[model samples]
Target: MNSTRFTPADAAELYGIHNWSSGYFRVSDKGEVEVTPGPGLNAVLPDIVDEIVARGESLPVILRFPQVLAGRVRQLNEAFRTAMREYDYQGRYQGVFPIKVNQRRMVVETIASAGYEYAHGLEAGSKAELALCLAQNLHPDALLCCNGFKDDGFIKLALWGRSLGKNVVITLEKFSELERVLKVARQLGIRPAIGVRFKLNARGSGQWEESGGDQAKFGLNAGELLQVVERLRQEDMLDALVMLHTHIGSQITDIRRIKVAVREATQVYSDLVDEGAQVKYLNVGGGLGVDYDGSKTTFYASANYTLAEYAADVVYTVQEVCKSNEVRQPTIVSESGRALTAHHAVLVVPVIDVTGPTRGLQSIPEAAEDQHQIVKDLEEILANINTRNYREMYNDAVGDKETLHNLFNLGYLTLRDRARGEALFNAILQKLAKLVAGLAYVPDELEDLPKVLADKYICNFSLFQSLPDNWAIQALFPVTPLDRLDERPTRQGTLVDITCDSDGKIEKFIDLRDVKATLPLHDPGTRPYYLGIFLMGAYQDVLGSAHNLFGKVNEAHVTARPGGKHLVELFVRGQKARRLIESMGYEEDMLRGSIRAQVDRARAAGRLDDTQTVELEEDYGEELLGYTYLEYEE
Candidate 1:
């Protein structure tokens, strides 16, 4: 370690916190990660967690800043508005937050409440989500867009929005859904507003490019779309067509693809106007990307374009196409659910333990004469290794460790010998790690030694329950220590969750240059340490699965008020064992009875007295009602 001073700025650069946090988060002078949710309002993340812990809450809690949520909503809408102003666009911009991004009541309600000022609305991709939207006290003019496949009941519920004076648009996912819509409208004797989702010839760039082109799972082909327009014309229902929509997928990376898609969709929009259909809105459905990696590249985890650039391309491209076609410009609609919600919720997990190949592990001393030949060879490498012979000694130690392992397995050495050999090997690697860092250039084989020797941090949260996207889709979220930015990180490590599954660990982390196989972390020792998984508000909460029956973690909703004040408005405790099992179809009473039967059997077999049986039953009952996660003693 050098004698130079380290600062929070250095830590910020090391973790790329400023690179990906947008503007909502930063490190304070006191080495704490401070979140500024609104003007003149800020809160320290560790301080909030301390408050929760003070109330006897457990590890792995989610802290949501509704003010931060409001900030994102405002930022997105303002981005499009700025684009429109800069591009001199005549079409108005309205953004809708699709509930599928994060169907939690607090999340959706925050967006709806913040967005009502800009006439922003809700988009539902399922019948249940549509019901969720209908229950909100949304702005009267906000577009309540009902997407996805529609049954008769789905269409009827959406049509009922018209009776209640809500601006509901039933978008046709497929040609067949249009028939169901018409049937429901006829039965209700009300002409409902309609939107057609078109399958574009232009494709997007990223993991979900197929969501736009002709191979899309939903949306109508050119011929099918024309047929719908013609049939609507025949039934004098063409005027009900109020919106033209297309989605190029979520998290689109490239700006060129968006420009292409917008141009193509606008051409179709102009053609529909020429055919006498009254379309008031051109909806470019959700694909605004969040730059997860902060690289600003076309990587799977990053976006190559800024939100401002995306808005400009959509507005300019549409204006160019509509003007060329000599048609009136329609109101621009965007359902940018990801961009509006990915930054508000932070999942804070505790580091219960830290491990490595030889972390705090002691080796026994033995005479050289009694040591095995392979172990002696490793001991020699440990003795003579330096910056000069380090390369050769590293190679020799690597070979000797394997041979030592084989000799132990073959009964040529005892457990103590094996332990000594393992310690020597870890020592050799640690020495090589230091030597390789000072070298002008390291060999390719030795370059990865540092990452391989990094520590393993055992976190107290289940990745399957809190950050499922990272497991399922390889989404990279920024991981950083909540406090301790003033000190230098002494080791690198990967995050391992407390799940039983072998795959429940975070190996890949976000980096400005590329993905990191390991994260720089501090040693927690006997004290409590915390790590936060940021930008997890989008889809992660709703998409998580209860693998190992972990269920949901505790959640705290923090509202940042003016004058640097904040309040913990709500704290939602996680699922208990009883609720988890009951949700899995196990009756609570039956489960209790089964345990009681076992206790009775034990009592009858003279394994317990009456007092002991009663105590055991009470303990078992209390455990059943306890939190599903592991409990720690205070």
Candidate 2:
């Protein structure tokens, strides 16, 4: 009998998640986590996961749900289209996927394929990314936005794209860039549509607030913008200036700030049009945020408004400004990379262990005769009367702890006595705090203490390699165990990655006080604990590095079929030892041969027996085929 009670097979039947897909987590009929099945298993997850594991894959792997990506594209398009229609907005809304967010070929291809209907396009910030966008063979009508600082090569590539009949818009970040674009366009004999990135006086709120305002690195100031227009006019290339672009920042939280930024940009559009700049589009650079916490409240990395609300605001605000200026409504373009891609991928990691507070005395032992009075005082405090006396009792217990510490320091008590006193005092305080919590009068610091004391699960995944934004900028992503969503999570624990670096631990978590310094995880013993880090599809992939040589995790794409069956396809396996070695500039074949020669020499010298040699060779072979480190299993 298969000892696995819940498998990926079960997850597919219930959760509607399919393999080869990159989004949704397939929950089993019995409420378990697994890859959604493919057509072979009627697209059930348990069978897929079992098959993969049978092939020697591990428990912790990333399952990509492609349907989620398709769905997100559809949702975004429908939202903007609806807003445009409802408001009778004259200009259409077009979206572009920023390449800097995620440059993976599969991800970009998927977005390009799914977004064909909406004239959705790709945005590139670098030459390589521009090449990828150009190679995508995007829909003929789609816009191809080229951003970031430009060199001769980058401008040449954009102009070349235009020569191929691609709707390439080269956004000028600096005034000098226009000179380069002109040079490139003239050489290529292709007048590519030009866009000027305007640095606005308005500032947005959140982590990316600096992406706008006076200090913003990108975009031209008012004087620079005027100079660019004059230069373009002098060269008779003014008509090529078709788009006015401005990006306040990524993950903008406040809707009001966006309104301000848009209003200001809209006025700029009017001013440019009034000056005969021939502006046809207002490209609001990507700032759409994700609701990582599910709180629906604005956070540093989240937006205050929904997609519909955001689209409506942009359309209405732009229309009002355009009507007032008597200029035709310009087409609205948004490089909303985060909101579009954030929900498309989920990073699933497994819990390896649960750590607890260090062991100590439970009650005041018989050794503490001199500190007996202190223990008695703690007990009295623990048996407090009511809220009226709770503060007074807490103060008394604190004083007693200090007195006991002083006694121990003065050599009046032994280490054992001090330990007993500390344990008793802590126990008493815990009890009192629990009582106060019941009455809803617990101190702010003590609010989460009870939960913290309950459990501390140590997960097996690298925070830096997986969620760099969370570690670097304190960006919070939704993290919940892939399995056991049905059961309440009781343990509040900091996640510890496999890296030896001290910074690898995730202590700050999303909470009311702050984004979680740590997360509340379930005990691993009860089940195979796996956590899903959601809304990380954007930026995380490209930004991730092999810190400590921990390469990417095993990845599979999941897709939902029209019928009930789900399709789970293994898109890419995690990095193999050979691949990692090659990346680090070591030839895998040479390294293997050298190691084998060493082993053979050892065996010839009688330093290793035949059995040991065979075992060592087999282990080494396995290492070459598997991920960087052997996942430690308890």
TM per model?
Answer: 0.97, 0.84
The alpha-carbon lDDT assigned to residue 605 of candidate 2 equals: 98
Q: Write the per-residue lDDT of candidate 2 for residues 1-634, one digit (tens) a residue.
A: 1334544454332222342123345555555554322332224444444455666776556666666676778888899899999989988888899888888777888889989988899999999989989988688878999999999999999888987888999999999888888887788888879999999998878877777899999999999999988998998888999999998988788888888999999999999998889989898888887766544566674456888888889889999999999999998999988887777677777677776542223544655545456666665665564567766776777788899889878987678777767766666655654567667456774566554454455666777778888779877766655656445444557777887788787666544334554565556776566667666888888787788878787777877564435555655777776787788898867877988999999999999999999999888888877777446543
Candidate 1 per-residue lDDT over residues 1-634, each given as its tens digit:
2447778888888888887888788898878888887668788889889989999988789999898889888888898899889978887998899999999999989888999999899999888999999999888889999999888888999999889988999999889888888888999998989999999988877878878787888899889888998989889999999999999899998888888889999999999999899999999888899898889999878899888788888899999999899999999999999898999999999998877764522543454457777787887888789988887898898888888889888998988788888888888888788778877899888878867887889999899899998888788999999999999988889989999988899999998887898998888877779998999999988988888889889899998666445689999988888888888899989988998999999999999999999999898898788877777997
The list of candidate 1 runs beyond 4 A from truth reads 1-3, 358-369, 561-565
* Residue 206 accuracy (lDDT) in model 1: 81
Cα distance off (Å), candidate 1, residue 219: 0.9
Residue 145's lDDT within candidate 2 is: 91
RMSD in Å for candidate 1, one decimal? 1.7
State the TM-score for model 1.
Answer: 0.97
The Cα local distance difference test for each model comes to: 0.88, 0.75
